[model samples]
Target chain A: MIKLAVPRGSIQKNVSEILADLSIDIPDYNRANRVYSYEFKNINDAIARSFAEKDIPIQVALGNYDLGIVTSWWADELLIKYPHLSIENLILFNDSVSKLYSTRSNDKLPLNDNLDEHIIVTEFPNITTDYLYANRTTNYRVFEAWGNPETWLNGDASIAILPEEKLTDNVKVIDSIYQGGLLLIGNKKNLKKIKESKLFKLLNEYKGLSSRSPFHFFDNKINDYVNNTKKIYSTRKQIRIAIPDGHAFRHTALALNNAGVEIKGYTDSEVIQGDLSNNVNMIINVMRPQDMPQAVSLGLYDIAITGRDWLKNFIYNYPTAPVFEMHDLKQSKYRIGAVVSKDLNVTNVNEAMEVWASQGIKKIRIASEYFGIADYFARNFIKSEYQIIPISGASEGFVPEDAEILVEGTETGATLEANNLEMKDLILESTNCIIGHKNLIDNVNPLIVDFINRFQ
Target chain B: MVDTLKKFQVIEQLFRDVLNANNFTEIRTNTVQPLNLYTSAGTLTPSMLHGTYSFLDWDGWSGERVVLRPDVTVPAAQWYLNNMEGQEAKLFYIEPVYRFIDDKNNREIWQCGTELIGISPETANEAIIKLVTELLGKLNLTTAIKVIITNKDNNLQVDNYDSLPDESIAKRLIKALGNIFDKHGFNYEFIDASQNKKFEYYTNYAFSVIANDTEILSGGRYDNLCEGLGGKKAYASGFAFNMNELIKLLSDEQ
Candidate 1:
């Protein structure tokens, strides 16, 4: 299947025109209220998805899509990070004539001097990493942004790399990366057929499309890094703790409040990095509880607070993994259970199996983000083998349509009740708990242990 | 360093037993080879060369650099061309190949599969598909495997290894190969080579075996790879199972 991706925002209109000129049209290209993606009914057999400008390059690189149209800056950004991903630069469609340059408010940061004390903020961390490397400056901490680069110049940062067009009148250009524009990148997986196909060759010869490709070497002062030089972290005499973000944030805040540990800059902020007491260094960073198990076991974080259910799910798959559950905070309580339609008489695993067997369903479909939990549950409860269809969210919605049962983390059971799904098997109860690396308990300082004791 | 060697051994032995039944002799090639051979064969890229563990020629062979063989196919081709001399030969091998996977991780790959040299197109097609299917069956996969076949003639180009004149020969070969696939009752789908090409040296067909949405075994026909390497023109076909993938899948199943 031909899967193509286009950047959703900003450059959408320009690319829509370029695609139109090439006789490859996407429906509702110019409509302001148009949906994120469209499938062309024209002779071309393709499925196109509209992704965030930065995500387009990664989607194309991972071979999820055959082709992607993204800014050259993002393409260069991902290439610098993942050089081995098979992405071929097909042709440059349009030149936005925008150079990725660093801007300053009033005091322009010197290029050659020790940027050691300065804060370098950018939306493109990999590109900033390259810029710092090429300039031979390592004494700066890069502050990654979720949005608004200009707002950063007024605050903690002195320099921010934004597009020339996006820069404000108050911001002055200090340095520039190479000029980049719209680039057509093909996946390495699709290279075999797409690059060699005669039809693709004809499509590459589109009129009004600029022949100049921005993906090339630079001879100018904006030099490229010979190799990627990642900043080495100096060993600090501080403990690292990761607090779960998103749904678990409120519970985490409440738990910290009760424990008398001051974690500043968490509430009313999307900040990933925050500061905590000196007992725990680097403040308290936020990450998904789902990712906490692997991260803590890898010793990236000395301590983490996540759901015991999540840890249970991890141990279900990898029992020998090095994860130590230190304390159960009794926060963010939830139940891991299977839910089916309320209309059905099924109330338990054996009853669900009976219904599935009576219906002569050979392979029962179960949906869950926790595939290991679902698979283990299905295998143990049902004598017949079942197919576990993974879902990211809204596991209850799939119960009546795509799946017969949904194995989900049920909190309050309101959403399940609203969806007309009845709780079947109460798999396990879960709550936010303190976890540490079994092999790295010594790394946790005494102050951190005392703090955990208060919570227990 | 990988603890999955036991899993590799199980799959490798199954492949050994299957290929032995088909009268293909198991052979071992050198762990290291001349870097020039791969370059001369028009298969080596600068990136691949940079990834290879090559050094100053200590063997006193006129400063010719050597590397730990990046793939079993090249060494297999060189061996066939040197010994067989265009004679029909069927060989299978299970060995470690070194290549660039990424910057941070180890590049050593455990490759195990069959290599056919100086064989007819019809015979090679039947042998290659059967061997790959047999290996997949031996893995005892939880689900049925799907084979995505790239038509040999769909990507006719002026590549270094093209020995055929008209495209009609590739057409007939495709039909013959399709028949062989049909006879085995293999679940297969056709995709053009222009969409998903693997090796630079593949001139005819390339196919990948997928189960659980993961590509486990991949290989294709390199009809003129021997001739491109300055050997006598001979038809060759081979397939290799990434033994690590087999081990991972089997481990999860067990």
Candidate 2:
């Protein structure tokens, strides 16, 4: 059977239409409530599954699927990092091209001269590394952010290499990396298998149609935009505070407001890297709470307000790291737990192990947004060989199929129950707290201390 | 697999015998090393750093990652700086280094290597080449080997032996290698070549001992490596024999 892997996000609709045009119809694809895996109705002995766009290349490269439809950038990202991956680009869909660029917060920090002190944050670290090496930038740390690398340009990071669309007006584009579009990639070893299958004919037809008339999905014009807007940057000695942007932003904003700390443009309803002109010594930057602890230890920030779970996760990986939760806001609390499907007929982890053993399952798959914590929980509690599948989101759908258990944080356990899953064990209770580098507490700046004391 | 391992042990024993005879102390560094040891030290190239098997351990919550030992020479220099600062030392190792190469089966390479720290480059280079030729002579593959020496300059093609510049370190090294081989009544060939991209740490020169077109041994003078790895400035040079290649060549011959 020809197993195919397809993307599940923004480009999913276009890819589904392409597949349909090639006479491969999987009705479940691109549906509102689509299942991960589906059987093709029109094609004999063929199946398809939807995965995260970034994960499509990895899954295909591992030979888990014979054929994969993914964005060429994701394919390039993987190839550039691990050049030996047995993946070949088969068909090019020139329509969905994305331009990647090297952008900076300001021209103040001369890139070449101050490279030792520069911090480059990006979603595509491999691509960023290639850019840095090509430019002879030997000294710099590239931190991989979950999303929105451009948001880090506000004093926390010196440079950001991400897509053109994500670039904010405050940042200036230094140079542009070539753009890549959607592609049909296949495993090199499985090419014979793919050619022998029914996909060979459909792919041939698609290639003929594409060559005759190049596919055009979107405008390919390069946006020659350069913003010279001067942004506020904190000196090395200035106190930088990183706060959450997504779910915890509202609560953190409320807490900061209630504590009588006025960060302009940052309110319960809205979050911003607002004008911190009033608080002359302090700079406020909004970023992923998951990224804050490490950023603080890297001296990118002096103090950060992030989840206790993230703080613990960071500490677990780097026991010697000088970042600690300085003050617990005691708000937005949740329980980090090991979750399993309700149909498993097991109440606790021990019972689940017994059930798994009875089912002859040798290795358990644990999925999590927090990989370190998942590894810790699996090692200490599971008592079985387990692999941690690091995921970004949609982790709830992993159980009963993709993963055997999910090490996830839940506020009410309502979301878990909604997905027909139940908490097997409580790993830890997490709450939003103020985490800071040890240097912040040791140096004891009176203004920083006074600001931190207000939270109490 | 058992037979191959026996051959490996035999090669290991010969290496130990020769290294010990040359006043080299056998040192084995940790199989698991901190990634910061390499990154903060700035000793490895970008390409070599990418090939390391680095991962966050169970306690790696602080975002610090560890790697399976990728290169032994750096660790050997680090060990000397930590333990024998300001002292000259001769060290050797018969260990496995983990690297992610194109060939998956060859990721775990068994290498027999030597490092001389706090010695002058000229002495260190001659001593290493002498030691390598001695070991190869012991293995009875002395006649089937070619020693290609190159410094920061000069590009010598594999087919052209006359391209190496005269009155250079390559010439001096080749002459030194020739004298060492001739004194032992051994058969060997010496050529010159360009700097290898793999030896980014090599500050002065690099040499490779090729047997049947396969580089079975390689290393060079990396004088700045000691200071680069957060240690005091000291001269260091080393070479490692690829036991996998040696075993394959021997097995094929047998």
- Compute each candidate's TM-score over C-alphas: 0.44, 0.80
**Docking band of candidate 1:** incorrect
Model 2 agreement with the true structure over A1-456: per-residue lDDT tens digits: 888888888889888878877887888885788367888888878888888888778768767688898877788888877788899877776643667877776534422222233567788877766555444343356678887777777655667777767777777776776576778888999898887788756866775214212222132111222123222443355577887888777777667778887666665464555334246677777888888887787666778999899888877766777788888888888999999999997889889988988999988988788877888888788787888877766665678766789999998988888889999899999988888888866688777788789987
CA lDDT, candidate 1, residue A60: 74
Whose DockQ is greatest here? 2
Write candidate 2's Cα lDDT for B1-254 as tens digits: 98788778889988998888889999989999987677655567777777888776654533345799998988888899889988989999999999898787999998999989998776886787578657765664434668876665334443454555554556655666676667756667876565675646787778887878888988887888888777889988888999988887554232
Which residue pairs show backbone clashes in model 1? A116-A139, A192-B194, A192-B197, A193-B193, A193-B194, A193-B195, A194-B194, A276-A283
| Candidates, DockQ | 0.02, 0.22
- Candidate 1 is scored at a TM of 0.44
Kindly provide the TM-score of model 2 when superposed on the true structure, using C-alpha atoms.
Answer: 0.80
The reply for model 1, stretches above 4 Å from the true place, is: A1-227, A230-233, A269-282, A441-444, B1-197, B200-254
Candidate lDDT values, in order: 0.66, 0.75
Which DockQ value does candidate 2 get? 0.22
